[model samples]
Target: MDLRRLAVAAKPMHRTLHALPRPNCQDHAFLQMRRLATTDFSFLLPRRHAGLRSFSSTQSVPLSEVMPRDGSRADLKILPTDPDYLRLSVESMANMSRSEVSQFVFMMNSYGAVILSSSNRKEDRLAPYTMLDRLFGTPVPHDSMNEYGIVEINPANPTSINTANPIKEHLPHTDDAYTENPSMFCTLQCIQNAPSGGGETVLISGAELVAALSNKELKSLMTPGMVSLGRRPASDGSWLKVSSIPMFWVDKDSGWLQVRWRCNDGCVQSIDSAARPAYEQMDAVARHAIHQLVIPLVSGEVLIIDNRAIAHGRRSYEKGEPRIMWRKNYVGDGEIASELRNGLCPSYSSMFEGMWSMFEPKLVAV
Candidate 1:
């Protein structure tokens, strides 16, 4: 075989290889061949290149269609009256059969949340964590706050602006939006219901919100670094951390829609001027009465929400009300966790690995 002729003839094959969608392990041999072919043909190239090009195997992957495989269509707007809401008795969690577990996982993926209630009126602080461990392995630690990872949501400091510490209504928001990767799931177990019949938990579907936005609005929101999330200054005038991030985006790999939102003034530090209109529009839709599911969690009930695809908050209660709850955030593990990992979306951490080093310092100063 004439080696030079073979190399020239393989030029067409190189274009075809580049056109292939993200390659699997089986395609590695072809990728290596392409690499070698490029090396062999380098002498034919001009000494002065017009622009630099990378031959690395890790070029950016094309954005996939943003449709979830778990039947959670972007257009399906969940309502308070939606019969498909996943609700199960606490007993089911304790003794879930394999098929039952599968159903539970399926519902969780489709609905972005699951509600578990017990008939007995008892206060078990450990029940929520216990059930979580049984179903999803282990809970994620709250490294900034405590060693035990469980956070007690109550009227601890009435004057504090932190939503979890005060009795005021928490507008719909994702927890830890400032961090590179917020928890994938979070659980809120009601130990004591609000006596004044307030404090219902509100959940808004991210998929539905995406479906409602106009193409222009969605594009603006999805632009990189269009929104910033961070903690406000402490009483002593010191900043914690800040992140310049996208408010909405689809993962290039899984094609799942991801959202990072903080409606609270304390966390939502800034929005780019161009994205402000779209951000405002999304906020309006998220807060609209029709788009929210108001779940009044009774005592002995635990609600698990997929933080990647749902935003959660609470209605206000009267000051000094004896309402208490246990909240735990989870990164996910085990079989159900595996399902979540492979599902349409994933935690934001994967998408912004170096975000803290790149943006945190500058944003904190601003």
Candidate 2:
């Protein structure tokens, strides 16, 4: 039988499966069988590897060899390059044309992060916020801040160890990992730069990290309730927490991998002792030099990161140095502009479907 023809025939059945109400065991089994029938056929489709290659500049490296067994940081230095590190010579974020905005969206979706530099000198702090609102939607409000969800990252007190501190290195972490639904995207606009150097932004692609994982490690990371994240006070004077959460899962809607990880001391309440080794291995992979992109944002430069796809951190700068950044988190509108969406290959979903299929049974069993 021609698998292509079977795949085509299976779509109507899949739609019927979706139309049915929430599935019970029988229905779920039927759905899984149907999905396997269709998706397995995807393997026979004409593969378009070129589009996948164009999606990101970084290539997957062997996880076992990428870092040392002791998990120490590598001495290698990886330079900033292409799609991930873009330098736009535009005057200001507000002045960007429609095409430029489209370009930004495409690059962000493809590479998972982008650094844009502009010449706008006006102290209009709202510029970055407004631009983000236009692109991704409303910002996720800060725990205790203005309605705009803007948080200033400046060297306020040298003793503090939070984002406001410039003396300590901020380990790579996905913002809002404590929350059940973390922000889909985040932005950092450099209002000022540290004159003494340092404070460079560090980014690691979650896709690259996932690609390097062993099956055992991936399974351990994906196990729900194996981790506990969050420890913040809610409005009712009660502490908010996600007592059980997974470090990795595939978003059903977007077919994109989602990762929630924070290396902070208090944020991660606990990890399943059984899965501790895998969690530590993941951290090691993220910190490996080959997977890191260190970029220093200068004044008037804005950095946008797909929080769902990349983890970001900062290098410690000279204490009391005048470095300032405006930070905000945003939830996607679940819609991509036509100009940007058209550039992506339709077969992109096929690439992740196999991974999702591999893990679906385990997720369902849990």
How close is every model to the real structure, measured as TM-score?
0.66, 0.69
* Model 2 lDDT per residue over 53-91, tens place: 331223322334532222111111112343333544456
Pairs in clash, predicted candidate 2? none
Candidate 1 local Cα displacement, residue 318, angstroms: 0.6
Candidate 2 C-alpha error for residue 219, in Å:
2.6
Model 1, span 318-337: residue lDDT tens: 77778777778876764466
* Deviation from native of the Cα of residue 233 in model 2, angstroms: 9.2
Error of 1 at 327 (Å): 1.3
